[model samples]
Target: MNIDLRVIGEAFHQFLINIGLTSGQASLIDWIFGALILLVIFIVLAILLIWFERKLAGRVQDRLGPNRVGPFGLIQPIADTLKLFTKEDITPAGADRITFNLAPTLAVFSIVMAFAVIPFADKVIGTDINVGVVYLMAFASVSSMSLLMAGWASNNKYALLGGFRVVAQLMSYEIPMAFAMLLPVLLAGTMRMNGLVEAQGQFFGLGWNIWIMPAAFIIYLTTALAEGERAPFDLLEAESEIVAGYNIEYSGLKFAWFYLAFFMNTWVLSAVATTLFLGGWQGPFVSQVPALGVVYFLGKTIIMFVIFAWIRATFPRLRIDQMMSFCWKVLVPMVLVLFLLTAIILKLGLPTIAVWLLILLSNVAVFVIALWLLGKGLEKSKWASKRLFTPEIPRL
Candidate 1:
């Protein structure tokens, strides 16, 4: 049960060379194989995610979900995919044909590219590039362009409005998200994904960044909810408001691409959050048995994903203005403050325990203050005023 993945990988690479391939060609094949493995793993996970969400939503609403498709509806996503394949592919008559055709591909592609830098386990990264964090940020921004293309190219008013919202929402949220991301890099002193994970591995994996920088972790998840366009913050595709938003005109497999990309992006965000704050692949015995690291990583990621699903199921969507205000007025300033505090604390040359204790107390203090301020702001809002002070009409 304990497989040495590094040895297997090396053996495969040598086998490719033995089959009359040049060293360069063999290396390219090795990379392609790695990419394919990642793709296959994600595609399978995407199917299960769709099913899990459906079941979760159904149970939340007191109903059985997709029981007719297969045993526990395991085959439902496959059936759905086939149905989408059979549906007619239509391009709106006035659409810019090229951009419309390319947008969905770009959306999915950008998310997939983000996986290139993530470490699933020890020695399990795709490419341990020095600028992996920057690489992830760059590709994530591409989704904005893809959204704009889909909306504008379709020549539809609703799509155009959704596109406008994407620019405003994603760009604004990225400010806080970027600042939140920088906290881990600042603490770890490296931008590599593996480095970030390794930095949290001290003291038998009990030294997670989440313990010392809880505020940043919360800020990152909040901004991630906005960045992924998940529920509550999902103004970009407010179905009641924008009629399915930017991808309204897409049909069949094209629409499926957008849908798949949304869920995949959710997984990616959860995985990144896990790696950064959860001491990814750092469980007891992981160093002794490397394969267990993969299991630990996946378990943590799934827990994070469940948090996302629970929030989606329970919280109502925010109005567009409220979402933007929360990011700029709340998360951005809080992250900036924490970032400054961290820098000053690091420069103080404190002992390890003292540094962690001070940072932990700072995070807790900031979190409580932010919540108190947010509650005060809510109490002052018109809705709260009306609800608290307005006379209730007698029910007939």
Candidate 2:
């Protein structure tokens, strides 16, 4: 049962080389095949995520969701996909046709490109580049440009406003998210995703970065929620306020791509979060059984996504000002402080255990201070002292 897919892949690769194909040609083919497989995986996961989120939302609100479509509502997403496929594709008459069309494509493309650097399992990555983290950050930012394009080219004021919000929201959140990503990169002393995972292989697969730098993990998750446009941070598509936001002009298959990309981005960010904080693909017996690494990786990613869905279901959306204020007034400063503390601690040339202890203590202290400050700010707000009910009043 110890089926290492890498061995099979390598054998197939060798067979290609033996059959009159040049090494370069074999590699090209391998890459293309891998890309196709990854794309297919994205599609499948998008469907599953849609179904899962709907079901989770239903459960949170005490309702049965999509049960009639298929067993446990599994086929609902597929049905929805078909519906989108058959819907009429529309383009606004006065819109910038080229940019409008390209926006959704770029949105999906940027996310897929970012996935190129994610290490899914042991020896199972799209490409093992030296600056994998940098590569990921670069591609992820491209989605912002896509949103801008979609919003500006639509010739719709609402879409334009939605696009502008993307710049304000994603750009602000990304600063803290980038700094938060640095904790693991610095700890491992390498920007490579695989290196980060291997660095956490100590302590019987229990030496997760989250244990040492929980504050960074929290910061990253918060910013990531905003970056991925999830609930509470989903001001980008505030349908109530902006009439569906940047993709408001999109419809039919064009709209479906944006929809697919949204779910896929959620999964990708969850995977990256797991890889950074959880001992990604580094569970018990994973070194002996490499295939199990994929299992571990996916399981951790799914758990992270569940946390995301749960938060989306529970928390109400934040006002735009509150969201931006939290990022700038709160998360940015906190993450910057956390980054500096960890950096200074690691530079002290202490023993490994001492470094971990110091970093953990610093993270805890920062967390408590941030909570106290947030509480104080909340208490000062007008809503704090206002109450609809009084202890002395009887029910009407």
Candidate 3:
């Protein structure tokens, strides 16, 4: 019958019906089945990502990493998981035991909730909410609060400072991130994640939003990194700075939860990018064989993950002040301008290609202008260097 929207889910419902279940019961059962499947897939990916990151880091740094565990160190994640499980759970003597323990769990849980809206294939989303895009952003904001919990609960000055840093960072970046996402919403006229993908449909299976809104794509990627706590945005984990930041006092499995959440956030960020810009499950042959959609989605996600790892390997961390300044002084203004530009273009009722060209031009101009300003600022900073000139004596 109607397998066009969500074939896998529809097939599962049929299977349940064959077993003599009523429609309502089968629908409920199918949802549970999908949820469980999504959970298992998330865990498997988290394990693989941990291993991949370590191996990538080792190669980048010219050292062997996790060579002794499994084939090509493939079982390294399993070993690490066991290690964390076996370690002592140390709660600081001065810590608030309840919040200390609960924060990590909440950290992990908040991100896991995002797995529900991601569509692995058409109709295969975990109960596609009407406002899937908004849901993801809201949940992402909620996860940051968990960092505050961890930092304050530890009762250490460093932990408290790290919490403040996270709040400040999240606050600074969230605006640009949300505004950046609205570009796609502006074009698609819907906040549904699936709708965003479908709206990108064009001649020759190339309706991805990235081509239409390249500036938004770049901004989204940058803000996504900040949101996910990836380097060079990983101020939360600055060991020499804040003493390992919010999770400083965490150890053992509780710490493991925070650790997993960090990487899991990375995965979610990449997946969301894939969905919004790269056309989540939209690809050749996807219409004929729906399972292929999952392949395309995963492939794009892996590529995004590699870029994340490359940044981690290549760039040094930014100072907290620098990070905050970049977000506010730079990204915020750029995205705000982008928002008005998007509204004006849509209001003008231009041809799709014309709209695409105008936006692309604006994005290029913004990029060039941003670089020029940054470079000029760098030159000014060079002139202001205390080493380059005598330090002005303070008039006491």
The model with the greatest lDDT is 1
Top-TM-score structure, candidate number: 1
> Each candidate's root-mean-square deviation in Å?
2.0, 2.3, 4.6
| Candidate 1 structure quality by residue, lDDT tens digits, 1-396 | 567668888999999989999999999989999999888887999999999988988888789988988899989999999999999999999999999999999999999899888888988988889998888889888988899999999999999999889778999999998888898899899999999999998887668988879999999999889888898898888989998899999999999999998888988999989988998888988877999988999999999998898888888888887787888888988998898988998889999878888888888988999999999999887646654766789999
- Pick the winner on TM-score between candidates 2 and 3: 2
The TM-score, computed over Cα atoms with residue i paired to residue i, of candidate 3 is: 0.92
TM-scores for every predicted model: 0.95, 0.95, 0.92
Candidate 2 per-residue C-alpha lDDT over 1-396 given as tens digits, one digit per residue, 9 for 90 to 100: 676768877987899999999999998888898898778777787888889989998998899878998799899999998999899999999999999999999999998887777888987888778898878789878988998999999999999999999778999998999999998998999988899899999998558998988888999899889988999899888888999999998999999888877878888889999889998889998977888999999999999999999999898888887888888988988988898999999999999999999999999999899999999997886545554466787769
Model 1 deviation from the true structure expressed as Cα RMSD, one decimal place: 2.0
Better of 1 and 2 by TM-score: 1
How far off is residue 141 in model 3, in Å? 1.7
Q: How many residue pairs in model 1 have overlapping backbones?
A: 0
Error of 2 at 314 (Å): 1.3
**Which window of 10 residues has the lowest lDDT sum in candidate 1?**
382-391
Tens-place lDDT digits, model 3, residues 1-396: 233656556777999999999999998888788778888988999999999988998899999888897798999899888899899989999999999988998998888899999988777678677899889988887788899999999999999999889878987898999998888888889888888878876754556878777888899999888888888998988998888889889999998999899889989999999998999889887778777778899999999988998898889888776788788888988898888877887788888778878887887787778778877876776333634767689999
Sorted on lDDT, best first, the list reads: 1, 2, 3
Number of colliding residue pairs in each model: 0, 0, 1
For candidate 3, which ten residues in a row score worst on lDDT? 378-387
lDDT of 3: 0.86
* Predictions in order: lDDT: 0.89, 0.89, 0.86
Look at candidate 2 and tell me the lDDT of residue 48: 88
